[model samples]
Target: MLPYKNEGEIRRLEGLADQNKLTNEQRTELTKLRNERKAHEIQVAALFDKDTAKLHSELEKIDLKASKPMTVSTTEPI
Candidate 1:
């Protein structure tokens, strides 16, 4: 997922750069949006890490289950 809140902050900053009038509440809103985006990014990365670990664990179990025992053959002397 993209960081929409961050994008909004960028837009707001651009407006500020253009000298657009902004209320105090709008400034606070922009700060809140940026913080929320950061938090969301952290959450998404953590979830990805968890999922990757789970997949690796599952693959290891599959490898363990799919392994075969070694066999030896004996021949009589002719």
Candidate 2:
């Protein structure tokens, strides 16, 4: 029996070929789907980077606050 991994890969390739069948309509549809998916991935990456930058900036502010010495009240002894 073929290994499961090999079987899965073969099946996946077959599905790809089937999806990209020789008909012009199938080809066009495949191209459209692929392009849309690529565009979506780019948009997601940009958003992720923007969010990462914002989080890093916030963390830096927090770290700065943490590094400063705090004043203790005269009534309170450490």
Candidate 3:
């Protein structure tokens, strides 16, 4: 299942589990759902880290370009 779908289902199950007593099976299911959600969260965080590194590299290139001095050419008869 997609991460968002797993997140929604996890929330729903948590609400239900909080409201009433869970049977052994339901408790086991809840534990599995929680682990799945945590795994997805870790995957998402890794993706974010990759994106952030790419952005930082691009920003550094821009800064280097901005910091360089410009040259001016003069063509005139003297």
- Model 1, residue 5: distance off in Å is 6.7
lDDT of 1 by residue, 2-57 (tens): 45546856686768847967668777777777787788888988988999999999
- Give all candidates' CA lDDT scores: 0.74, 0.64, 0.78
Per-residue lDDT of 1-78 in model 3, one digit per residue for the tens? 235556776677788789886778877888998887788888888888998999999999989977777544223445
The TM-score between candidate 1 and the true structure equals: 0.60
For model 1, the run of ten residues with the poorest summed lDDT:
69-78
Pairs of residues clashing in candidate 3: none
**Deviation in Å, model 1, residue 28 alpha carbon:** 0.9
Candidate 1 off by > 4 Å = 1-20, 69-78
lDDT of 2 by residue, 1-78 (tens): 112323444455447678764456645655666666566667778888999999999999989977787756523787
Best by lDDT: 3
Residue 12 displacement in candidate 2 (angstroms): 8.6
Which structure is stronger by lDDT: 1 or 2?
1
Indicate which candidate wins on TM-score: 3
Task: Indicate the residue-level lDDT of 70 in model 2.
Answer: 72
